[model samples]
Target: MEKRQLTYKDAGVDIEAGETLVERIKPFAKRTFDSNVLAGIGGFGAGYLMPKGYREPVLVSGTDGVGTKLKVAQMANVHDTVGIDLVAMCVNDILTVGAKPLFFLDYFATGKLSVDVAADVVKGIAKGCEIAGCALIGGETAEMPDFYPEGEYDLAGFVVGVVEREDYVTGESISPGDVVLGLASSGIHSNGYSLVRKLFFEVLGLKVDDYVEELHSKVYEALLEPTRIYVKSVLKLLEEVPVKGMAHITGGGIPGNLVRVLPEGVDAVIEKGSWPFLPIFKFIQEKGNVPEEEMFKTFNMGIGYVVIVSPQHADRARQLLSEMGEKVFRIGEIVEGRGRVVLK
Candidate 1:
């Protein structure tokens, strides 16, 4: 009797399929390129040149996964938007450090390879990279036949960026009188979804197809909207404002995220009433009865990014952000205290 031959294809993983997907994605990937992108898809390593004329450029890299949002994607059978969520997670963190995103990489794992499914995911990543002014440099697609259920997959992103040492933005320069400028968020942005899932699905008996105004879509569409990418518009305002520190309101919401940058003697004192809360947040508030404090610390509440700048420059900073097509609010102030964030 002849024995069966062993092959990667026999294990339900297909290199040929991956190659075909890469070929298909190349055109879409190229749209994100700048002159610095030295190579495209199908390379052992993706390359980008150091932007010319940086006095002392420091490379920044951040790796992140879209926590639990993947569950929403899997449940809804929507794979595209989660790829954007992957990129947003990394790029948003890099933006907090004043870095210009250069390139991004993704890691996708599934029990079985589906070209159509993965292609939808990559399309989202390419679009996200384009928005962040970054290239889709490289990524890993793993097919672990027995590791996950056939219909389930996971996605994560790694992003690299560059910022000059002298031009870096951090909390060292943040002072007591600096104003806290809040940039409004679109829904929850990517955190607290596990709780949301419990609320909408398990507890309330809501189906993915159920329509809710708070979600602004059939439950699935509402959940699948990509996390907003804020790098480009805010980077443009760097010229006119004296930014001392910045924070991306993510998993820990305002208090948790903002305090990451507070100096030893300065704290972020936020007043909740300065800006109008989006109805979605209010819906969650009423439906969940999530206390104001729990809501602020657990979710973005409304603000996606918090900017610290001088007291006198507050108006100009707020004005410049507003001029750039952003909703701005003087949400709080810096106070002389321990390095912590306080919400009023």
Candidate 2:
């Protein structure tokens, strides 16, 4: 008897499927390319020319994953928006330091590669880069048999940005009497989904498609809302206003993230109710019986980004951001205290 021949696909790796995905994603990557992109997708390494016009350019980079939120997208069979979340999480962090995002890359890993799913995910990533005014130069897609569960994938994103060394906003300039302005979030921007999942699924026995009157949308729709990329508006604001400090509110919500940008001898005193609480937060609080403090610490609440400016420039900054289509709010003010965030 002759032994049967086996191939890579038989062992759960599909080289052809991976190749097809690359072909499908090339167009999506192309639309995001700018003059500075020396090399893009399908290369051994991507190359981006350093931007001109800065006397002293500083490179800023950040990396982050979608966390357990990917589980929700997988459960709903929705694979697109999480890619945006992936880009937003990384780029937004670096943006806090007044960096202008230059280029982005992604890492996608799964047990088996689904060409269609991977294409959709890449399309969303390209869309995010377009929104952020960055180039999606390259990415890695790994298919590991028995590593990830069937039909599930994980996403990680990396972003590189540049800022003039003299213009870097390190939060050291934050001082008493500076006004705190918040840029409203587009509903649950890619954090705290572990608790969100428990309260909606295990506790309430809700399905992804189920709709509650309070939320006014399906569970997956609200949970999968892609994170807002503030790169454009904030970058524009930086040109016309003197922004003393900035914070991208993520995992630690207001208290955890806001305090990072507070200099010693001053505290960020956030005025509660200064901004409207989105209904999803209200639903989570009411349904899960979660404490107010826990809710603020775990999720973004309503504000996604915080900008600190002097009182003289506060009104002008708010006007500029609002005109740029962001829901802006004067959420708090810097006061004399130790480096901390106090919620009133």
Top-TM-score structure, candidate number = 2
**lDDT, model 1:** 0.86
Cα RMSD to the true fold for all candidates: 1.4, 0.8
Kindly list the per-residue Cα lDDT of model 1 for residues 1-344, writing each as its tens digit.
99999999998888898888888888778888889988868788888888998999999999999889888888888888888888888998998878999999888899988888888999999999988889997888888889998788888899999998877887798987889999988767789898888878987789888999665678887767778888887787776777899999998888899999988987788998998887767877788777888777778888888888898888988788888778888999998999988877
Cα lDDT listed for each candidate: 0.86, 0.94
Model 1 has a clash total of 0
lDDT of residue 248 for candidate 2:
94
Cα deviation of 323, candidate 2, in Å: 0.9
Per-residue lDDT tens digits for candidate 2, residues 66-173, read 999899998998988988998899889999999999999999999999999999899999999999999999999999999998999999999999999999999898
Off by over 4 Å in 1: 213-216
